[model samples]
Each structure stands twice: as structure tokens, then as C-alpha cells.
Target chain A: MTEVLSGLPAALGVESLLAMLAGTLAGIAVGAIPGLTATLAMALLLPFTYTMDPLQSLGMMAGIYNGAMYGGAIPAILARIPGTPSAVATVFDGFPLAQSGRAKFALHVALVSSAAGSFLSAVALMLLAPPLVEFALQFGPAEYFWVAVFGLTSVSLLLAGAPAKGLASALIGIAIGLVGMDMITGAERLVFGVRHVAGGIDLAVLLTGLFAVPPALAMLSATGKHAEGLGMTGPGIKVRQALGFARTWLRSGLIGVTVGVMPGAGGNFAGILGYSEEKRAARDDSMFGKGDPRGVAASECANNADNASSLIPTLALGVPGNSVAALMMGAMLIQGLNPGPALFSQHGDVVYGFMWQMLFTALLMLTLGFAGAKVFVHMLRIPSALLAPMILVVCLLGTYASTNSLGDIWLMLAFGGLAFMLSRAGYPIAPIVLGAILGPMAESSFRQALLISQGDPLRFVSSPISVVLVIAIVTVATLPLGRILWRRLRARDARRAEHPPPLRKDR
Target chain B: MSTPPYHGAQVGAGERLLVHAAVAALGGAVLWDSFSQQGASAYFPTAIGCGLILLSAVSALKVVPRRLLTSEATLVKGLGGLALLAVFALLAGEAGFLSTALLFIPAMALLGGDRNVPRVALATVSFVALAYVVFHVVFAQSFPPEFILGGR
Candidate 1:
């Protein structure tokens, strides 16, 4: 602990501080822009960091990592579009809050929750890196498969009223994810010989099409007179109301840190799981998908909490948990610093400084977010007609810029159209995204586990972690049925109470 | 009478049935494709296909009251907006992002009933410039060349 504090002085240096601020600001911008991602921004910055001192480069990357996670919520709250994939869960309640004229309040909740989560994650990363990395290493292929399955089942709550449609949507996503070359056999499985089919559908393109375009279409559907700025000047949430969500923040923070430490999972998965778990734990989940602040708190908190903890595996065991962590590892390698225990022993000051930078950057993000939010909320003031087109333009430009592929743009439009139809048909969209993200993870791990066990189906439950995950999956999968059975029993009891003939029926 | 229980979309039983049928057909198609594949590659698709079929069947058996997902007027307008987006995508490569966006913004604004042409034009120009600065200059990302603007 003292060693960690000793590094703080170096992290607080002027150059390092400036770099951190710049990265955080850039991260927020990139994250807030539809189709632009923190991974892309970090990848772009990786080369330039080669010449800088290790602390400066690491500080900057940490700032961006935390900042982008929070920045994604801005678009999610003000517009229905999630700026980053992790912010997808935030859209469940944040956008509704915006629609109900609580945009400021939602943004504030997201910002605070994000800071709280990131701080907790950074603290966990500092204190528990070795142990968490050891626990993460315990996950074998079978366990990873079960983890993916658990992730899929946990978010079933998002399906809520339309379980069947939601399940179908998830299946559809899995099917889409199945398109292109088979990862294991290198065979063309589902390609219909379309151009770029071999490369598979990009998740970014899918997300942009599914989440961003539909809102624009909805805007065009409305009449000229908008909802008078969607309550732009409405009262913000009170501190007391915000404090009510502290428990949610803490729980989501734990979920995020745990997921982050595990390989093959990322912030998006953590955020969704946190939101679902929050809904499940709530006494009344009726307001969950309808602009509940707890939903925003859980989602934002979990995603930001994922930021620093994701690097625990990378720094401790040289295993990058996610793409952002992989890039950070690359940055470290470029600085001639190899990750693992040797890194701590050899470069204690720099590594611990990096950890300090993560904590400080999170605090910096909270301040900057609040300052910028006042300006961002004015997005509501734009006439819906203009706002709609502007969003369309941003989506089009952002999609095109992502890969410079015209086909991807066309593909996005197709997904957008499909999403528009599915949403109108009353399907939950989040599960589809979840399915697409988890399908490949689940399938590959399942296949690997099978190969390892010589095709034994029981291999899935051979490990303790796998057994726990399997139980969790079964419980989550049956939650809807449990609710249905409970409802029926309650209704029957109500009926018996209504008519005293029920007493005679007992005889 | 008390309100009918509804979750997301409120549509006629026929529409719901049609959607379920479509889902079932999609599942069948996927299942059929999986039969020709080999090894672990086929396992996931097969599972997803079967799940889809079963879920759609169960959903078809459930009773739900009929309601409108959106008003007819709004539906027409929304479809129009989608059509415009399709047109924009097709033309973007040929006309370039700037030229295409220049035309798309005004068309979409007008379609959305924004009759203020000057305001629309200003917004269009400003957005184009901002995009150019951010995407082209800061990011150095390349876009399709504009024949209309001398290969911008």
C-alpha cells in the first residue's frame, strides 16, 4: 500500500497530468460519438505513446479507458443511441429518463455511478490483483462456456413481458453471429456467397444499425412540433435521490470487477449483467425498464468499474482480458516493459503510478462529465426534424469512418431496418446484442471443452466454477417461469377471496 | 373493464401469428442449412434454430389482445424516412460523404416537416465542415472521393 502511494507523486506530475486530461477528454469525445470506440482511440494513440515515459503513456491510457466508459452514457442518456457498446444497458433506462425530461438527472446518475464504479475497480485492482488473477486463471474452457451461458441467461430479465420474442431475438442474433467462416474448422458455414461474408459481420456495424438508426426513423415519424425540448429545463435529480442508488453502485461495482478480472468478458457484458441483477434484486422491478435511476446506476457503475479491473489479469499474469486491455498491454510492451510479476519487481513505481492514475482519472472524469453535461443536454433543444437528420448523418459518417468499408455501411442500414421492424413487433433489442457478443464466446469454448473431454457432455459440469455457473444459468433461465407460476397462484388466491364459493370448493 | 395486459407492441393476433410463422420459417431454414455442415460448426446453429422454432411455437399458443404498434400516419412517415436512408447509402460512394450529406440533411429535414430551408442549409453546412475537420483533419480518415466537389 505504501509502495502504491509512493508512485502517486510521479503520477501527479504536470506532464502526466496533462496527458491524462487530454486522453480523458479525447476518450469522452470518441465514446460520445456513435460508432467511435475507446478501443479504436487507444489503438490510434498507441504508436504515439512509444516515445513518452512509461508513466505518462500509462496514465493517458488509463484516463481514456475510464473516460470513454462514462462518455458512452452521454449519448445513451440524451439520445437513444449508445455511444459505446457497454452503454447499451444504460439505454434501457437512461433514454427513457431523457424522454421524460430527466436527461440531466440521468446523466448525473450515470456520471456519479461511473466514477464510483471506476474508483472501486481501481482500488480492487491495486489491492487484489494477484488473487483475482489467480481466480481468473481458474476458468478453463468449460468454465468460460458456462460463463457465456450465464451471461446470456442473466439478462433474460431485459426481455421482461415478451420472453418468447426476446428469446427469438437472441436466437436471431446468434444466427447472425454464426454467419461467415467457422472459427474452428475454417469452413464456410452460413455464408450465402455474399461479398465480405467470409469476414463476418462487425459488431460495431450491427450496434450502430440496431440502436442508432431506429431513433432517427422515429423522429421522422413524429409531427413538426416536438415535445418542447423533451423537458430540457426540467428540474434535476436531488442528491438525496442520487444517494438512494449507492447500494446499486456498490453491487454493480463488485459485478464489474469480477467480470473484468475474468477473461473473454468485457464491460458491455458486465453492465448488462449488473442491470439485470439489479432488476432481479429490486423489490419492485416495474420501473426498471421505464427510466429507473437504479438501472442507470447499475449499468454505468458496472461498466466503469470494469475499466481498471480488466487490466489486473494483464498486469499480473500477462493475459489481456479484453481488447482494451490487449492494447494497453501492447503499449506497455512498446515501452519495453514486459507484464507479469517481474514488471512489479522491476518497475514498481511506474506500475503503481499507473494504478494511481486510474483512480485519479476516474475523479477527473466525474468533474469533466458534470461540466460538459450542461452543454450536452442542449441536444434536446435541436428541433426533432433537424436532430433526426443530424443523428443520421453522424451514424452514416461514423459507420463509414470505422472501417472505410461501404459494404459495412450498407450492412448497417439492413440491420437498422430489421431492428426497426423487430422493435415495432415488441422485441427487446438488448438480448440480441448480448446473444451476438456471447454466441461466439460460448460456441468456441463449448467446442474446446468437448474436445478436451473427448466429447463428454458432462465435461461442462466437471469443475466447481462450471457447476456454479450451470446452476446460475438454470436459475436464470427459469426465472420467467417462476414469475408466471407465482402470478397464477396469486390470481387464483385473489379469485377465491373474491367469491366465498371458494370456501365451499375446499369442502 | 380493466385494461388488457400488454408488454411491448400491441398488435392483432393475425400480425403476431404472421411474425411467429416467419420466425418458424427462419428457424427451419437454419436447421436445414446445419444438416449439410460438419463438426462443431453445425452445433451452435442447430441449437439456435431449434430454440427459435420451439419459442415461436409457444408464443403462438399464448393469447394476447390486439393493439396498434404505431399510428398509420406515423408508419407511412417512418417508412418514407427509411427509404430516404436507403437512397442516401446507395449514393454516398458516388457523391462522397459531404455531397451526399449536403443533400441528405435537407431532404430528411423537409421530410420531417422542417420547412425552414435557410436554417436547414446552415445546419447542413456547419455539420459538413465539422465532420471534415474532425474526421478528415484530426483523425485523418479517408472518405469516398467527391466527383461533384472536384474529388474532395
Candidate 2:
């Protein structure tokens, strides 16, 4: 802690402060746009970082990561469109609340919860990195495989009303992840001979196609059909409501940190777990799907929490938790700063700077997100007719700028169409994103674990941690069914008490 | 899963079977290809494909068809918007971002339903200029290629 405190002055230098603030604002704006995502923002920032000093670049990236997570909730609340993939679950209730004109309250909840979640996780990173990384090091291929599986298990049951669709969506995501080069043998599996795809399906390209395109098309289709994007009622902020949400945000943040510290499970899992768990816990299920402010709290908080916590494994074990973290790793490498135990010892100042910067950046997200909320709330007043086209342009330009390829633009359009069709058919979209993100991690780990044990399946169960993880997967996978059964039994008992069972018809 | 019959197939019991069957076939293709890959690399894809197939089989039981896949207006609207985007993409490389954006924004607003040419023009011009100033002028970081502009 003292080390981090000592490093604060260097981190607060003009260059670092400017870079972080600019990155955060840029990230928020980019992320709030319909087609832009946190991944795309970071990917775009990667090249720009080439010119900056290491600490400044890393601080900028941290700001972007933190800011982007919160930025996504803006569109999700106001437009029913999620700005980032992690915000997908936010759409469940956010749009509904926005529809009913509670956009102000929802935004306040999201912004506050996001800040709390991010701050707590940043603190967790500061206090727990050394110990957590030590624990993370004990994880072999088998443990990593199960960890990813545990995340998937919790998320696959997210849409309990549509498990089959959820599973199908997850599988589709996994198949997409299988594209490009194989991790183990360097063989291509599903690229189908296209150079673009063989290079691998970029997550940002997919996100834009899957999230932005459909929404743009939807807005265009709805033009003049009905009044949408009406201005939100400025109910003004409430201190009591915020205090009431402290417990929920704390719980969600902890979940995020726990899941995020595990490699391969990123913010999306955090969002899914946070939302679904909150949904189940809510006494009024009807209010949940229809835009409960609590739902916004659950999602925004967890995803932001994941922002800081996801870096834990990356900084500690030299393993990127997700693609965004991978980009950070790229930045570290560019600076010739190797991530490992030696990083702390060899470059204490930079390490502490990065850690302390995360805390400072989270505070910035709160300040900027709060200050900017009213200004951004006005976006809802713009006519969708004009807004839709502009958003599409932004999406197209953003996606194009990331790769500078017409090929990616075309792919974005195609995937957008397919996503539109699937969405029309009631297929869950989050699973596809999750599968793509986690599929390879799970597979590679599973395979490598097997190889290490020389093809013995028993090795997974041999380790105490792996056994615990397997048990956790079973527990999570069965939780929905258990809840359903418990509910049914209670209902039956209530019905019996209300009236005796009907006499047999035959009698 | 209790999917409400959408647009209106209006019954429970197998409304989604067709969709599931379609997904199963897609999953099968994934599985078949994975089988052809090498050992370690093939492991995860194969498992995922199998899981997909199995889950799809279960999904086939819970079909509740609701709304028509996509409304005619939506289809036309989405397609029209996509067409405009395609034009922007093709022209982006030759006309340069600023030029393409200037033209594309107004056209898109028009297609999207703005009749006020002055408003459209203002929005388009300001947006294009602001974006250019921010992306190209300020940071000097992000620049997409343009053929006619000699970017390549």
C-alpha cells in the first residue's frame, strides 16, 4: 500500500493525467456510440500508444477500459441498444425503463454503481495482487479449463426461460471462436480459406456487426412509425436511492472481481452473472424484465468491477484474462516491461503507477460519468431518423479504422444481417459472444491439461482446486432447476392450504 | 423455456423445432469439420459441437413461434440502411473519409427520414468536420486508408 502511495506523484504528472482523462472521455464517447465497443476503443488506442511513454500509455488504456465499461450503459439505458458486449444484459431492463421514461434514475443508478464497483475492484487489485497471483500460479491447464467452464456454466443458465436457445447461442459462439489458427497445433479449423477470417474474427468487428448494425437497421425501420428517443424526464438525482444500492453494488463488484481474476472469463460473464442473480433474487420477477433500476445496478456495477479485476491475472501471472487485457499486454511488451513477479521487483514504480492509476482512473470515471450524464441524456432528444444514420456511419468508420480493411466492413454488414435474423427468431445473442471469447481458452486448457497428464482424464479430478471447480460448475448448472423446483413446491403447498385437493373425478 | 409464440404460430409444444433443427445442422457442420482437425486442437471444437448438437436437440422441444421473423417494413428498412452503408464503405477508400462522410451522412439522414435538408446538411457537415478534427487533427492517431486521397 505504501509503495502504491509513493508512486502517486509520478502518476499524477501532467502527461499521465492528461492521457488518462482524454482516454477516459474518448472511451466513454466511443463506447456510448451504438457500434463502438470497449474492445474497438482499446484496439484503436494500441497503435496510438506507440508514441507515449509506458506509464502514460498504460494509464490511458486503463482509463479507456474503465470509461468504456460505463459508457456502454448509456445507450443501453436510453436506446435499448448496448454500446458494448458487456452491456448486453443491461439491455434486458435498461431499455424497458427508458421506454417508461425513467432514464434519469436508471442512468444515476448505473453511474453510481459503476463507480462503486470499479473502485472496490481497483482496491482489490492493490491489496490482493500478490496473494491472488500466487494462487493463480497454481492453476495448470486443467484448472484454467474448468475455470472457463465454471464461467460458462453460470452464464449458460442466465436465460432460464430459454436454456436451449442459450445453449445454442453459446455453441455458436464457440464455433466462431474456433475460427483462425488452432492454439495447440497451429492448424486452421473454420476459416474456410479466407485471409480475413483465417486471421481470426476480430471481436470488435463481430460486436459492431452483431450489436450496432441491427440496431441501426431497427431505428431506420421504425422511422416515423412511432415516437422514440424522446427526451428523458430529469427527475434529478437521489441520495437515498444511491445509499440503498450500496449493498447490491458491493456484492456485484465482488462477483466481478472473483470471476475476473480467473483467466479467460471477462466482463461479459460478470454482466450475465450479476444480472441473472439479481433477477432471481428480486421479489417481483415481473418488475425485473420490465426495467428495474436494480437490474441496471447489477450489470453496470459488475462489468466495471471486471474492468479492474480482469487485470489481476494479467499483471500477476502474465496471462491475459480477455482480449482487452491482451491489448494491455501488447502495450507492456511494447514498453519492454515484462509482466510477472519480476515486474514488481524490477519496475516497482511503473507497477505501482499502473495500480494507483487504476484507482485514480476509476474516480475519474465517476466524476466524468456523473458530470457528463446530463449532457449525454440529451442524445435521447435527437430524432432517431437523423441519429440512426449517424450512428451507422460512426460504427462503419470505427470498424474500418480499427483494421483499415473493406473486408472487415463487409463482414460487419453480413454478420449484422445474420444477427438481425437470429434475434428475430428469438435466439439469445450473448451466448454467441461468450462462446467466441471463452471457447478457445476452455479448449486449449482442456487439451493441454490432458497432454500434461499424458491423456489421463483423471488428472482433472486429481487436483483439489479442479475438483472444487468441477463441483462449482455442477452447483451453478443445477441452481436454476433447483430454484424452479423449490418454487413449485412452495406454490403447491400454498394451493393446498388455500383449498383441499379436488375430489377425484371418478369418485 | 417458455417462449411465447411470436408474430403468431400460437401453440406451444414444437413451435421452435424447426429453428432447433436448423441450428442442429449448423452445429453438425461444426462438429464434422472439427473431426478433421489435428488431435489437441480439435479437442475443444469437437466438444463444443457435440454440446451444441445435444442442446439443440433439447431445444427442439420448446418451440413457440411468435412474430414473423422480420417485419416487411423492418426488412426493407434494415436493407435500405445496409445498402447506404455499403455505398459509404465502397466510396470511403476512393473519396477519403471526410468527403465520403460528408456525402454519406446527408444521404443516410435522408434515407432515415429527415426531410429538412438544411438540418441534415448541418448535422452532416458538423459531424464530419468534428470527427476529422478529433481523429486526424488532434491525436493524429487514427487514419483509415483512401485510394483517391493517396492514403495507401
Candidate 3:
């Protein structure tokens, strides 16, 4: 505690403070735009940090990390577009709430939830890094495969009303995810002679197409119709009302931090898991996908919560949990600070100072994001016709800027068209995104586990963690079925009560 | 899972069955392709193919048709919007982002039923300027070479 406290002065240094504020501002801008990922922004900013003092550089990174995670919720709420992959779950409830004229309320929920999650996650990292790192290390190849499967199944099965459509959407995504070079064999599996596709579909392209384009198309289709209420005005939800969601914040924060500590599982998975759990826990989940504030809180809180906890592994064991953490590790190496336990012994102050930066930057984000929400809610005031075209422009420009590949833009358009058709068929598209994101992880881990076990199928259950994960996957996959059976039984009882089952005649 | 049909649309069971059947066929084709493959990489796809087929069959049995949410007019508009996007993408490659965006915005706005030409033109200019400032000026992103304006 004393050693950690010693870092506060450096964290509060003028340079560090300025860097944090600037980085946070830049991060918010980067994250609010489609296709400009926090990962890309941080990567671009990494070089500029090399010559700065370690605390200052680290503080900037901390600010960007927290800021981007929260900023992602903005576009997701006002439009149906997710500014970042982690914000996808936020769209489930955020967009609906906005359409109901509760844009301000939804934004407030997201802001508070994000801040609370990030703050608690930073605290968890400070106090629980060692144990979390150890726990993360327990996930073997089999466990990782099951974890991916668990995330995919839980979200797909519960996100929509029809389990069949949900699962099928995910299956479609997996198939699309398979349309590239196979990592294990180094051979093109489903490229079908397309050279551009041999590199595999970019996640950004798919995300932009699936999330942003469909909405734009919908707005165009509804152009001449009675102007759909964009919910530019509504009753204000008090900050205290947002605070009343403490239970959801804590639950989702725990899920986020847990997933964050696991290597390769980032905020996207955490957000999905948090949303699924929130929906599952709700007694009346009919409003879940339609715009429940709890859903936004769950998703935003979980994703932001992971921001700091994701560093636990990188700090304790030198294994970066995600790309941003890997970049942060690179920053430390550039500063001649080696990672791992010995680094703590050598530079306890800088290490703890960075954690402090994470906590303080999250607080800064809360203020900025709360104020920014007031401005962002005006996005709904634009006519849907003009707004639709503008959204398409942003999506187009963003996708094009990411890789400078026109082929990606074409692919995005194709996905958008197909997505619009599937959505018309009543298939929820969120699972497709979830599936694509998790598919590669699942496949790679599945192969690795098989290789390690020498092709023994039973090896999936060889470890306790894998066994638990397998059980979780089964339970999650069967949850919809269980719900259906329960509903049928209840209906049957109701029918019997209504007519006395004609058995009363026999009686 | 017990929520009402999506969008409150009434779906015909036969239509749903047809959709499921189509999905099943697609899954079957994938399974067949995976079988022809000659490596460990095929295993995952093969498993997915089977799961998709099985799920489609199960879904086929419980078809509840919802409303025809997308009218013919809406479908036409949706297709038109896609065509507009495609044209914009292709044109940008040749005319550069700035020139193409200038044309694309007004065209898309018109297609979206914006009949006010001056307002559309104003929106077009403002949006293009904002895009230039954000993407080109701030991020320093490179756009394709233009026959008109010099490329960034």
C-alpha cells in the first residue's frame, strides 16, 4: 500500500496530467468515429510517447484506454452504429432507448456505468493483480476453446427470441469467418480464387457493414413514411436513477474483469457476456433487445471494466492480455523498464503510478463523457433522410481509411446488403457479429487443444477448468429450451385450470 | 425466448420453412465442400456445417411466420441505397474520395427522398468539408489519386 501510494505524486505531475487530458480527448474523438478503433489509435500514438517521461507516456495511454472504451457508447446510442466492437452490445439497448426519446437518459446510464466499471476495475488491478494473473494462466487451449464457445452460445441463444434464428445467424457468421486462409494448415480454405479474400475478411469491414449500413438502408426505406420519432425529447433520468443500477454494475464489472484477465479475450467478449447475463437475469426480458437501460449499463460497464483489469496479466507476468496491453508493454520496454515481477521490485513507483493514471483518467472520462452526452443527443434531431446518407458516408470513409483497400469497401457493401435481407427475415444480426468475432478464437483453440491431446476428443474435459466451461456452454445452449419447456408447462396448467380438464366430468 | 414475433409482422409458416430449407441446403453444400478438403483445417468448418444443418432442421419444425416487415417499396429503396453505396465506392477509386463524396452525398440524399436541391447541395458541401477536415487534415489519411483534385 505504501509503495503504491508513493506513485501518486508522479501521476499528478504536470506533464502526466496534460498527456492524460490530451490523450483522453483524442481517444474520445477516435472512438466516436466508425472504423477508428482504440487499438489503431493507441498504436498510432505509441511512437510519440517514446521520448516522454515514463509516467507521462503511461498516463496518456491510460487516458486513451479508458476514454475510448466510454466514447464507443456515443455513436451506438444515437445511431444504430457501434463506434467500436465493444460497443456492439451497447447497441442492443442503447439505440432502442434513444428511439424512445430517452437518449439523454441512456447516455447518462452509459457514462456512469463506464466510469464505475473502469474505477472498480482499476482498483481490482491494484489490489488483485497477482491472483488474477495466476487465474488467467490456468486457461489452457481446451479451456479457451470452451470459453469462446460459451461466449458465442450464451449471447446467440439469449439475444433474440428465436433460438433457431440466433444460432443460425451465428452459424452463418462462422461460415463467413471461415472464408480465409487456415492458420493451422497455411492453406486457403474458402477463398474461392479471390485474392483479396485470401487475407481473410477484416473485422472492421464486417462490423461496419453489419451494424452501420443496415440502419442507413432502413432510414432510406422509411424516408417518405411518417417521420419515425428519433426520440429527441424525453424525461430526464437522474444520475441517482442511473446510480440505482449498482447491482448490474457490480455483476458486469466482475464479468468484465474476469474476462479481461484472460489472454486474447478482450472487451468485446466481456460486453457480450455482460449483456447476456443481464438479459438472462431479468424477470421480464421482453424489453431487453428493444432498449433497456440495464442492458446499456451492463454492456458499457463490462467493456470499460476490462480496460484496467486487462493490464493485470501484462504487469504481473509480462503476457499482454490484449493488443492495447501489448502496446503498453512495448511502451514500457522502450522506457527500459522490463515487465514481470522483477519490474515491480525495480520501479514500483512507475508501475503503481500507471495504475493510478488508469483510475484518474476514468474519472476524467466520466466528466467529459457526461458533458459530451448533452451535445451528442442532438444527433437525433437531424432528419432521418439526410442522416441516413451521412451515416453511409461516414461508414464508407471510415472503412476506406482503415486499410486503403477499396476491396474492403466492396466487401462491406456486400455484407450490408446480405445483412439487410437476413434482418428482413427476422434473423437477429448481433449473433452474426458475435460469431465472427469469436469464431477464429474458437477454431484456433480447438485445433490447438486437439494437437496437444494428440487428437483425443475426450481431452476437452481433461482439466477442471475446461470441464466447468463445457458445463457452462451446455447450460447456456440449453437455456432457451428450458425456458420454452417451462412456458409450455405453465400454459398447460393454465388451460387445465380454465376448463377443469374435462376430467371433472370423470370425477 | 418467449418474446413476440419480430416487428409484429405475421409470417407464413410455408415461407419460413422455405427459408429454413434454403439455409439447410447452404449448410449441406458447406459440409460437402469440407469433406473434399484434405487437412485438419477442414474439421472446424465441417463441425459448423453439421451444426448449422441440424439447427436449420430444428427451426424448420417450429416455424412461426411474422409480418411482412419489409414492403416491396422498402426493398426497392434498400436495394437502391446499396447501389448508391456501390457506385460511390467504385467512383471514389477513380475520382478520389473528395470528388466522389461530393457527388455521392447529393445523389444519396436525393435517393433518400430529399427533394430540396439547395438544402441537399448545402448538406453535401458541409459534409464533404467535415470529412476532409476529419479524415484528411487531422488523421492525414491518404485518398486515391483524383483526375480533378490532386490526391492527398
DockQ values, each candidate = 0.36, 0.33, 0.33
Best by TM-score: 2
Residues B1-152, candidate 1: write the lDDT tens digits: 11111112245667667778788888888898899789778888899889989988987888466665632124455678888888988898888877888898999999988898898999999988887787678876778886555364
State the C-alpha lDDT per candidate: 0.77, 0.73, 0.76
Order the candidates by DockQ, highest first — what do you get?
Answer: 1, 2, 3
Candidate 2 lDDT, A1-507, residue by residue in tens: 676676788788889898889888877776676545666566555544545798899889888888888888877777676667788888788778777877777877888888888888889888887676567768888987887677565555664356667667777878887899876678888776688898688766776676567666665554432223435565845898798988788778888888777654678789889888887877777888788888889898898888878787667756555657656766786688867666876887887788878888888988898788766554334555676777777777667666778788898887776676566556756556656766776787887888889999999899899999899888877777898899999999999999997888885
* Residue A341, candidate 1: C-alpha displacement in angstroms: 14
Quote model 1's TM-score.
0.70
| Cα lDDT, model 1, residue A438 | 65
The residue-by-residue lDDT of candidate 3 on A120-185, one tens digit each, is 899998888655445656777787687667766765676556888888988888888788778877
The single-chain TM-score for chain B of candidate 1 is: 0.76
Consecutive 10-residue window with the lowest summed lDDT within model 3 chain A? A223-232
After superposition, candidate 1 runs with Cα above 4 Å error: A1-118, A121-130, A222-361, A369-377, A502-507, B1-15, B68-74, B150-152
**Model 1 agreement with the true structure over A1-507: per-residue lDDT tens digits:** 786787889999998899889888877776765444677566546544645789888888888889889888877777676767899999999888988878778888998999999999999989987554456567788887876666556554444366788778878878887888888888876666685867888666776677667766766655565332233335666779878888998899999999987654689989999999999999999998999999999999999989999888678755454667757876787688877666777888888889999999999998788777666444334566776777777777767776678888888888887777666666666567657766776788889989999999998888888888778777777877898899999999998888757334564
TM-score of B-chain for each predicted structure, in order: 0.76, 0.65, 0.71
